[model samples]
Target: MNKFNMTAIAVAVGLIFSAGMMAQTMSKDDYQAAEATIADKYKADKANCDSQSGKQQDICIAAAKSNKNVAKAELEARHEPSAKHDYDVVVAKAEADYAVASATCQNKSGNDQDVCMKEAKAVETRIKADAEAELKVLNANKTAGKEYTETGMKEKAEMTEARQEAATDKLEANYAVAKEKCDALKDDEKDSCQDAAKMKYGK
Candidate 1:
């Protein structure tokens, strides 16, 4: 799809990968294996930078180092899933991106370099802010859902109580009317009429 969608998908894949790993029982062996993988990849990536010289070499080395750091952070996060760990992953990615962008900016000179660095920082800040805002919104929606559910249950209970009270009042009013009619009867007949009213009204 679009660039933003692609970037989001990539990041989501990484997080999903971590979540899958976390779903399993993590062990010391897993941790050591992850560390070894990162180290090997980093070494290979750094070796690629040796072919270049000057600023190009510096940029390549920076990118390799950034990638290594981000990988390690992601591995650690997967090993221990927590809010702080997740946040660390986000922060790591942001810093890595900034490092790459900043290194690339060094390839420029004079006023152009200043503008490049400024733009890089601006983008980094915006990305980080957006991430924080998304986290806050997610938490807020969860809280609101809980509150709405509780309120709904309370209101349902109150409505049920009100209905029961109204039924009782209606039954009493009906029994009063029946008793008034029974007043027209005499002695034993009146007692029989009152008994019928009591049975009909469940008094």
Candidate 2:
């Protein structure tokens, strides 16, 4: 129920997710073993969640699911390290974070909850946008990296465009969170808040 406890659960799951990503190419036996390990971990996580009640339990369940999802995605990333798979890993991480954030927001009410949800969304958006940019950059790097061929030039351009678009997406998400916070204010204050957000984000 406490913030630190929830955060610890999230961090613990995330650490496992990170470690899963570092796995090298595996033999059939190794892959199966890892797969089994993931399954066992998920079961253990779920069992731990069973000890809590109500909203705390829901958050625990969400965290457990997040852990399982990220583990699965990381497993695939390890099994096949491609732009698409790597992107999947990032997506998993984003979703995992969002799940926990959304669950935690239940602790708040009214505008506080709204802001919490919006902030969660902003984080998700940034992560997903980064994933997209990273995937595009990886695809672009499929070309002659660091070498100045015509194709390389095109690849570099694509990479730059992807990153720019991701940055724009992040900015827009931030603006949304700012605007959502303005909802807590009244009339002129709210209007000024929104105006400032628009100016800050170039919305």
Candidate 3:
């Protein structure tokens, strides 16, 4: 196979493995075994291609090497931290802002307290949304940086998808929290909380 086809095959295999094994953590021995298996397969593929003659042989060899490189890089990337620190920082800031906002609502009374809480929640939601967006961008940039050498367009597209997935995950988490908070309130307080959630998240 040519370099492009070989690369595609390797990517397909990697993706299949990635999809089949959804476990986030693997034992050291298992990880090492998996890596060795991949390396051996790559070597064998390269050796097979080496027997061919002329331009075909050269293309096959290049393809095998490219595939091996891509696989190795992908394995490394799975272990690499992708914007985890950045996301943590964003979450921390959002939590701090939310705390401050919640506290500000504590001293007021009746409608004033309700209004204050609503305003506070609005600000908190905005901060969280902004943070989530920033984190998504950071993650995309990280992925792009990692894959730029191999395939720029493919990496960019994957990173964009990853960001969207992350955003959806965050939104679901935030929505659950909002729902719980709304559930905790009673009567008009509940109404106020729902209103605040709607105003912040959308109707």
Candidate 4:
């Protein structure tokens, strides 16, 4: 199978790890137990990866590593329960995602690999920007000691801009993927594919 198939498997594994990490708020006593659970889960995940061979093995290992980081970040967020810690968890997941995508893209060749890398970076940039914007609003509110119901104009503006940026990132990423697919087609068909993508994304 292609590396893309392996990447799909990796995504599934990561998602399973994410599901395993969710829990209620943690006490000091609960911290050790959570850490142990994360470690055990990572071990099991890595074992699964170890069973695979070649590029599949690499992709599976990347997923395991990403999940481990995500699980640790989640545990920290649960233990500390602050905006900063929460943002850290988000960043961990984002970075972990990019790691897997980078690994998968590296396994491919030519335009597919190139576009996949670009799309991965675009996705990571969008997610990090969203996380940062959220942090800014959160820190701003904390400084003002204001409730969420009383958000200021600046916060609203930040959110609006963030939304627009995210939208653009998604559109551009989708466009890149779509256009790359068109490269495999003939002249008229390729033109149609490109035209269709632009029409759909208004690019």
Candidate 5:
């Protein structure tokens, strides 16, 4: 299946596992014991799968592991207050950074301003990329299939490329506007302005 489809499947698996785990209420010790058992199972499965030399075996092993990790994370989120707090903190920081970058970009002028905005967007993109990577790692740890992991990586790469292209287009448009503004200035000042714009926005 395609990367998008595989990611969807992995997410679905995670949701299902989480729901199943939540259906059972257990004491703290019981939960810990259960988690240990799951971890052992995961290790055993990984070893067995590794011993096999086939594509299907590898995929199966990966999927099983991914599902397990997802379940484990959900369990922790449900039982551990700290995990939830940490997750929230990371999300909040990312949002805050994005806002700061966007505001900074807005205060810039012409091509320079546009470049600044694009830089802000790049920061946002980086944040998103980091989140995605973390999710992917979690999924991988859970033993998500190789196909799913590979697909997620490919999708992320494509998204990054698309964002870059869009940012470049915006930069070009802003540079044109900057050039026009520069043209209205006197000779030396206009040349200097254009040079500054070019330096900020590129050729």
Candidate 6:
């Protein structure tokens, strides 16, 4: 791939994985339609390559196949969201790129061809490594999010318990004051006052 195309693919891969976390499964009809569309498109693309010859034909065929494979992987990832599917998309992209690059390398001769093939392999390895790293980072973020939510819940429960204790303490203090006041009242009135305080404080 050229610099511009590689950059575009990188950006796309990032967005795809980001969205993959929340992607819902596609409807059966939609999935089937997409599959049919991909098949038709691949056939048309391959037919276009038939006019070419030698290395040109190889390159054209490689490009057609790569595009098809990548599209199919992307479709699967969208239809069934999972870490495996997302990783598969990345793997498909790497393989597709390597296929194109290898085809291109065949146009060269001698040491030049060897060097080209090696370079293509290196690029494929790098892309695969990058994909693996991205997957690891995504998983780490997911784990961190879950831990944060659990911590928040625990803190909220503690706060609620604290509030209840504070309310109980206030009621007990008020009841003590009410009972002291009742002590100054005479016999029957004092008993009635204490009863009222007890009921009011839920003692």
lDDT by residue for model 5 (33-112), tens? 87888788788777777766655564556555554655565555456433232333333444444454444444457766
What is residue 6's positional error in candidate 4, in angstroms?
17
- Best by the TM-score measure: 2
* lDDT for predicted candidate 2 compared with the true structure: 0.80
Clashing residue pairs in candidate 1, if any?
Answer: none
Off by over 4 Å in 5: 1-88, 144-203
77-143: candidate 2 lDDT, tens digit per residue: 7886555766777688778878988998999999999999988888778767876776687678878
**Local distance difference test scores for all models:** 0.66, 0.80, 0.55, 0.71, 0.54, 0.74
The lDDT of model 4 is 0.71
**Stronger candidate by lDDT (4 vs 6):** 6
Backbone clashes counted, model 2? 0
Better of 4 and 6 by TM-score: 6
* Candidate 3 local lDDT, 110-181, one digit each (tens): 656665565445444544554455555554566567555656666677656755765565565565457556
Q: What is the lDDT ranking, best to worst? A: 2, 6, 4, 1, 3, 5
Instruction: Give the per-residue lDDT of model 6 (tens digit) for 1-203.
Output: 45455545556666667777688899999999999999999999999999989999999999999999999998998898987688789888878888988898787876566656655655555555556655655665555454558755565555455445545554555566567667667899999999998999998
Per-residue lDDT of 72 in model 4:
92
How would you encode candidate 1's per-residue C-alpha lDDT over 1-203 as one tens digit per residue? 02363256335633543354344435989899999999999999999999999988988998899889889877877787654555566767777777877888898886567656655555555445444544444334445554558755565555455445545554665566567667667999999999999999987
Question: How high is each candidate's TM-score?
Answer: 0.58, 0.83, 0.34, 0.62, 0.32, 0.64
Error of 4 at 10 (Å): 19
- Point out the higher-scoring one by TM-score: 1 or 5: 1
Q: Could you tell which candidate, 2 or 5, scores higher by lDDT?
A: 2
The RMSD of every model to the true structure, in order and in angstroms, is 28.6, 4.5, 22.7, 6.4, 19.1, 29.4
Local error of candidate 1 at residue 44 (angstroms)? 2.3
TM-score of candidate 2 relative to the true fold:
0.83
Tens digit of per-residue lDDT, candidate 4, span 139-201: 555544544444565666666676677567667777777787788789999899999988987
